[model samples]
Target: MPRETPMDQPLISPAQRAVADAFERMFELSRAQPAPDLAARLDRLSRLRALVQDNESRFEAAISADFGHRSQVETAIAETLFVLVEIKHATKHLKKWMAPRRVATALQFMPAKNRLIPQPLGVVGIISPWNYPLQLTLAPAIGALAAGNRVMIKPSELVPRFSALLQELIAAKFDAGEITVTGIEDEIAKSFASLPFDHLIFTGSTRIGRLVAEAAGRNLTPLTLELGGKSPVIIDRSADLDEAAARVAYAKLLNAGQTCIAPDYVLLPEGKVQEFADKLDGRMRGMYGTNPDNSDYTSIVSDRHYARLEALAADAAAKGAKIVQLAKPDDPAWKAKRKFPPTLVVGATPDMTIMQEEIFGPLLPIVGCKDAGEALSWINRHDRPLALYWFGKDAAARDEVLARTVSGGVTINDCLFHFTQVNQPMGGIGASGTGAYHGEWGFNNLSKLKPVFYRSPFNRLADLYPPYGTKIARLQKMLRFMS
Candidate 1:
């Protein structure tokens, strides 16, 4: 017989306590032992790689279950393969990244040498969203581990199936003190954010990011927020309509437009709105087909999310925007399966609700601008976006957009490709997000690069330290002249 637990005690405390215990153990170990050496870090990376490779099918299945019907190919490309690339990149570069860097000494301190040494922050906490659960959660963990910090993750409750599968798989490969995933209970998330982690990384909407920032702030925890905003696409007169339309349509429709960096709206020449919309509609239909049951298309995550997308379309319609649904949105088959039809809102104005918020679903609005200058002004007026896409052939026009606007990242003549570059840092600016992490940027972000200086015994710098003599005044005069 088992002893009964107290009914009045918080039911979620056990789950929260388990996470807290894991953090404590990891933190203590980080303090006691020197950061894991190169070989140990490599071993961890190898295990992580094997964990995904061996369980790829299961992960795809679980994520599909979470999304009602997530495309298997999308999972492979976006989630699993992406993580593998990150791990491989980090493994290949870890030694050079770990080595201390030489710093130039000042002329006055020429005899002394300076070095910047990278060391781990004790433990890192990751709060990941559901849209790309595996990729977002593990990408930062890869960076933290490469930098020699222990990791703890709290995945979104919306993807409970994937979250549970991740928790089990990670535990099998890693020690609790090395890396661990926590439960997705409401209380656990509340408790998880409040932990005094050495650093925190959150990927989600800006609204929730504020709450996480507030919690992390109380503990003075440094944070990397990967929040989303209304990322825009500019279609210049020089761009080929058919080519641009196909690329943008594919990008916008991927995972039902759940991606943070997906183009929120398109700005094209004033008169071409309808022409471009027809081209986009054709491309979207060609790729995903008219049936919502197409395996290539993914379902919206839940009924609530489905309804939200519908309301956005309806709201835009009410505001005099023409709503173009690729398939019938009211079809019982689509709604029963939680699939949201690909939609375009034409003649979208600034006053409409669709243009006001980050449209996280498969709804896109096409707004027209008088010229490149007007397009630039429109983007600058809002919160900086996480990503921007420009479609055109004119070098001067593209350069103008690049020079005038601010965004987390940009891709020319395409969408979502800049983020795939391992050499580039992935992050956002302003409300879109703050801080970047990818490849070496990630290793550097999670590290404490302490500067050390070696002093020469024969140097006369000590003579000017305390005594207010004539010699000190002469030295100070020379320093001022150098400054």
Candidate 2:
């Protein structure tokens, strides 16, 4: 057999080799300059802010193309403007977030002081999903850069136009070793996840999240997963039915209910199920009009997703479930545009497919609950959700729900607003995800909080050396007694 040279090694393909080389280069750069000053970090953030501000229209158009008919207003509010707010928040608080914190010293080390210094964790890898592509990709990158870490982002290939635009923008603005974006195929995505990164963050479906977790585990890499699940909303008896219905309609219809934190189901007071459904139906029609094709309603991402949603609704209807569709069933425009109308599924039981899975579409199941206690009990029976929403005026019921159920975050009297608070952390717990991010929480998660102990240069403890004398024993006895 012919000898194989180092350059001709066949362990990995050319594309994989290129990715490996990029990660290596970035890692080396991070080691050489571990700590970046506040000004430098601010400069990077400023550039990102400018990128969004300068090309707002381009982003709106690209994302609209990816989603068939994603609204310009929705794109601006949810993606471009949202990311700008994140950058501004990080820039405003970067100095305080980067400062070393003082900790109290113990009695055993009276003359010493303890401090916690936050340091960069080298290269960070982020795998963002297709839904809200720009926000998910850049939001986490904001934290990684704010923490003085190099970032390599792998955006979903499903949104090719947006991904290409993002790749172009990033490549033009940043050095490859500092910040880079990759839009590779499935096999390459797996290779990207398996890289030995200092940390990794993934935002997508629970199934894909599990795969990413397993790959990261092989390298023992720390991860922050923002997986989706059946996030429920409780509409208490005291809630203003009209107002709650309006807010829920707006939230569940945004991006056609393609958000991870979008309310997956609603628990209403048993007897008022019909009343609540009527209000929701009216509100959805008012917001988006009777024809989804003529309104700003976004289509399902692809035919496969549309088929899945159709099948779920069909299965529910076949199982004797009542479906309240807001649009005309005979409309051919919806079929051609791949737009599924806002649907409300009532009498949804545990055995139905719609109730079993996370409905990342415009399908909401209205589950009846006897009271607040029944609602809380039902929530506890399932996996922890990314978010929870409570709508009502009863402070006691709200407090009870907050204290009893566990979720990544909560928004009272509204939906999807908790995720916009830059000061608070946004992440999932248990099946939904792990590790929180956003604002200082994001900075802390990406950085290593190393503790330092500064000891005074004195010989007061010389008598306590390992001489095993009676005097030493007496000193030890005195210390123990004092403690």
Candidate 3:
């Protein structure tokens, strides 16, 4: 028997109730209007693009305020421009994606045509995270809108200013029945998850993903969870050390290493650990300077997250890990700004807290491996990550790693570039996440590829319809033989 969600119990506030009512109204409106033409979808996408473009400075400031010191360049590239690119991609290819695909009719059903129609899933719920709040929220919304479905977005409560601003922007550009944005506290988030949306998308931690999965499960709602794990970077012997270090440093330090697909740890060639660490340190220092306050580095999102990251580093150091701070550790100004310097943790073990969890901060653990096989074995030993980055020129080694490891996505000789490709699907496999969304994949995921069959007026199945007789048995035998 299925467990029931108690409806009589009031788990949400009046404001949350209003949001829920809005969702119900939007869902009904989506059903009544059913399929939206390409022109309507394009118009929605255009409005969304205009919304981001018009409020670029506001978005930058809001995100910067939320993060304490997020660089405008980073916001433009990662958040605003990223979404704009997605909109452009969707707009350019929506017609092809929406076209009904013809399927071959089997011999058993000769003369009957079959086609798969990509239809909207009515109402979709998007629950975005705070790390890249604007991009995460709007990217999926782009897909949902392109697929002609109504959307209700729940921005993370962690970034209150950004969430409020996003709500205002979305409300101004779209009708509530078409696209709506709301911010909810923890209790309301639970209620929001429990709603019977046609599809739900969540981007956040693996732990919370489990709860979201459970709630969505009760309603049998399909979900696309963009959860995070300890994404690993493998440094092959044939790799360029300096180049690898620079790419890894940029990815790990971007958004203060708070990115979901950021290289959580590096598996370096055993004997070259120090050399690789040195190159990485140089890259970090060059990128952000010796003083974190003097650079375009971002701070941790909140004091709680800051304390948690500090605790993880402290726990690892206490457990015999060699901590190497790349920048000046005792800088009072950097400390005051809550800007943690990029650090490298040597001698990380499986039992250490830093190794056990996703290090969504400026700490990179360097694990030594003798060869490519050892590195592959180490990655296989843990849950699949959101991404796996391999930096080397060896074709065989790269292909071997690709064949052996399972992850949401991968980038060769670079980090996080796989995510930038609009054609490819970005998502996880086992634990990191479920389903995928990006490009046409995102549109398809939000839509139901409903199979349609056009039966001919000249029917041939009447002989096998009702009578359980010798003729029917013979027909079945002949069909089985043909099959």
Candidate 4:
């Protein structure tokens, strides 16, 4: 097998001086209209399909080239098909999502009608991550479009090829001011954070999230931070061991464990840690093979990430944790491929770097817990993850974990399954994310609620006017105290 390699650096330099003048004036144009141009939006979506619909294989190849090992089927299935689905979903329910909702009218305002109108926030900035580039970027764009806001997107420079493809697609399909892909300078990312866009959505590490949030705050811009934490998967004694092993393997190893929602660590029942580890080892070999270079298993996104994982593994090893090599480190011939083995560390202490950090790689760590209760305590000690998975036959066990722990979402008996449901909310709590989007929730995230109160044209109820007398005051007091 050949040595793995990192993703190639961008051929196009991120603009240090972005064309802010055009973007600023575009913002002005948006403010003048203040309404979504749905017709223009439909045209763009139509063209998006035309641009890539027949060229699906090429898009998949572009992503695989960017990542060095993005599974072809998953790339097409996850990135392209999923975005297409989002487009269709947005197109169908967009009108309803944009419609004003009726609210209950109070007795004092009986002759008046109240509506909660969904309005578009002006311009939005989306900072997309390299992992799942197309899905993350396009999916959010769909939501923003449905919400009635024009947008500016900053695709992660890490996945340069895919980012380039997106820029080309947008430039050819839409007007630049409406939705242009600005390549972010390492500093431009921070500058974008400082912009006062009505809304910003960033998907990346919690470390960067802090900087983005702080910068966004300076300008009073609201943001949705899709940050990361160590998501955990627990294997209960009542669980089907084989099935649990398979699912856990799939969750953490998919996208080479680069998913923000990936299972960062695992809590296995005592006395079964070795068995689980052995099973996982064999399963990974079956999936990616004992040889990573030739295996369908993906490579790490970049050397920086590979080194981060290597340091974590080294740190854990130095601390006396047992290293379980599912596949030894990739061959040097594939060194430029950014390849690493699907490794696991056993007896991982809570203090280890691998346990503390989001292991966004093929490395998996197993910590032996006394029981499900102990597992919950272990997880409760850390920042809440975007997701949590517990496998068991006991209904009470499932409920206990769900009731005791706090996470963005939980998928009992399965891992990373929640994100597949397009209708479910996909943000975090505590640190993972504040808002969510996928289906209706995604549409809601990018929209604003503007309520309108209408008084009946022939209203004869003048009891609550400004010239209030004792009678009106008494009646108001009665209503206020009544319920």
Candidate 5:
């Protein structure tokens, strides 16, 4: 090859350039207007509400198209409704959340008041996953906007149709610098995390979360990783078998078990495994039906995910565990539609593949434990989960689990309900993920709560200032007396 000039070399891909331009534009605007007033923030929230409300039907259709077939009811309940609720909560409390609060000063600093002021962090970047695209993407944006910060979102490439629609909608509602959504290009995904955002929030698997964290670390960008792990459901002895089975079945089957907080496995009293498994299978079938074309059922995101779930089932089956699938896995109808059957892996052990990883599908493993202590030990032995569910009437057993093991959050008798509480924080701990955001927790996390102290000129504390004389001796004596 002949020697090439610097002009011959491509500096950046088109995707990277586009992302950089967007970031720089928003960063500049944020710098120019550091704090947005309550009215301005309210306007942004209102537009966001209008955007989703006006085109609910269109968004539902686009998301369904993207997923091959996402349930319309599920989309409405989980995605759009969740975002609207977050927006409503933030709007109602925006004025109060924006106000500076008074802080008490120490006795020595009397007449000097301290105030904690909440101000916007410049630019916030959100990297949302495809599982619940709309909710995960816009919920964080609501908080950042409520906190008066500019936002840029990078939606998952897996749902291109939905992502494109979201980008178009956002662009139409607000300026690119005010709130923007980027394309789902490979180059953009790689470079998006490298941008030095004032704060970045990522929602996805632990494997990808590590890479994102590494890239963000290079820019020292503060991150909130909403990652998933093998969260467990503990069926206490006092739990009503029928009630527990129904709740677990609904939770694990919703969105076809693509939820981050979905119950990955179950730990019930030893002898009750087979009975609970049977009940769970019945419940799953009753809710979604047996056919692949059931309207209430959701399809897997892709062929690869479908095959992975199959492999997990196969591995568990080959290792002496029994597989109870709601629909025949080999049926052409199921595979053709990309809908993996809801499965139960009974007699699952730690060595089984299904038990080793976070099954982001409809496959749920049921493992038996001797007692409550063994159940707690089993959970504590693994990585801390993002959410834990304990079903029972025994307060002691529930309290024991709560006090012993550490997880992101817990639901006493159900699943995923803790995440719906607007006042409670939603986040993970340890390997599951880190940091939290939801309602006020989100507002405070995304905002800079600066502490301001006003010094009083009238204070005579200066009397102890530099003159080493009888005054210093008197001060020493006074200090000794106080001590």
Candidate 6:
């Protein structure tokens, strides 16, 4: 890490100087013309979605490269499906979501009726993270386009291949004036944040989310920061270890555990820690095979991430933590690949390096707590996470866990599935993140709710406006009564 840290960097960057200016010029020209008829906007969005659907395979290929062997079927079923599903749902409901909503008029404003119009914010900037890049970008774009605003997508540079491929795919379908995807250097991320946008949506690390918010603050731009925290998966003693392990492993292996909503770590019942670890190890190896690489399992993003995960794993091992090997690391399964095989740490404690950091890799850290209550307390001791998962048949136990532990979203008897619920808002709380977006919640976040008040020619209270006196006192009395 650079010693100069945060202040060492400059916020104004090449992307800001070149790509942003180009998009701004294009947006200006597009806005100067009459708004695309609502029908035309729909047509454009349709074309955009169709283009994505056409090149869906190509996007999967890029994501595969980013993951060093991400399953194409998984990509299609997960990432591509999310994008298309969101777009399809948005298209089906665009008219209804766009319809202006009316409100009941209070007797105080006798002649006035109320309307809440969803107006498109002029331009929206989306900064997507490396995990599930396609879904993040496409989901936000649907809202911007639906609300009649142009979009500039800044995909994570960590996944360069996917980022470049997305730029090319988007450029092939849309003009810079309508939507643009830019491949920017990592250094330019701060500058991207500095751009003046009506709304900005960022999904990434919590530390960087703060910096993005500050840069946006300079321009008073509203933002939706989707950051991450130590998302905990609690497995109660009363739960089925077999089913829990299978589902948790699925979530942990998805994108090689690179999802923002991926299970960060687990809290097991005391004394059951080793037993749970044993079962988890069996399931992971049984599902993925003895060799992780050749077993259709994916690897870490890059050598940097691999090394970081490796170091954390090594530190835990050196600190007397017992390593439960799910998939052997040295098996022919290891082809000098960046693959970090599924590993579990037993006898692990909060003081270990693996427990201290956000393990965004295939390693699972098991923390033993006396009970669900202890697990909930441990969770509360840290930053609130983006999501939490619980597995148990005990209804009261589950309810106690749910009622005590706060998270962006909760999944009962599952992991990372809360994010699959499309209709609800998805985001973090406190240090994890602020604001959320999914389905119509995303559309509303990207649009400006311009409240409209229409005053009729009849029963107008002109005196309440300026020449206030006894009339104001009488109006106040009526307001109190109405309240």
Question: Which ten residues in a row are the worst by lDDT in model 4?
Answer: 3-12
Q: Measured by TM-score, how close is model 2 to the native structure?
A: 0.95
**TM-scores, one per candidate:** 0.96, 0.95, 0.96, 0.92, 0.96, 0.92
**Candidates' lDDT values, in order?**
0.91, 0.89, 0.89, 0.79, 0.91, 0.80
- lDDT (Cα, tens digit) per residue for candidate 6, span 167-276: 88778888778888876676567577877778889988888888999998987889888888778899988899889989988888777788788888889878888778
Better of 3 and 6 by TM-score: 3
Better of 2 and 5 by TM-score: 5
CA lDDT, candidate 3, residue 121: 93
* Residue 201 Cα positional deviation in candidate 4, in Å, after optimal superposition: 0.7
Instruction: Give candidate 3's error at residue 52 in angstroms.
Output: 0.7
Worst 10 residues of 5 by lDDT: 2-11
lDDT by residue for model 2 (44-86), tens: 9998898889999999889888888788888999999899999
- Name the lDDT of candidate 4: 0.79
* Model 5 CA deviation exceeding 4 Å by range: 1-11, 468-483
Model 1 spans with C-alpha error above 4 angstroms: 1-12
lDDT (tens digit, per residue) of candidate 1 on 154-184: 9999999999999999999999889999999
After TM-score superposition, what is the CA distance of residue 159 in candidate 1 from its true location, in Å? 1.0
Tens-digit lDDT track for model 4 on 1-483? 631211121223245345354456557777897585667666666666666676677778888888887888778776888888878777777667777798998766677899998777878889999898888887877787777777888888788888787788788877876788887467566566666688999988888888888888876778888888888888888988888888888887888888898888889788899999998888877787766566466778888888888889999999989998754454565556777778889899978888877888878889898877889889888888889888889888888888898998889888877887888888898788777788778777888887788988665456667677786877768678855
Model 3: per-residue Cα lDDT over 195-301, one tens digit each = 88899999999999999999989889999999999999999999999999999999999999999999999997889999999899889888988766664788888
The regions of model 6 sitting more than 4 angstroms off are 1-15, 26-36, 293-295, 327-335, 465-473
Q: In candidate 5, how many Å is residue 39 off?
A: 0.3
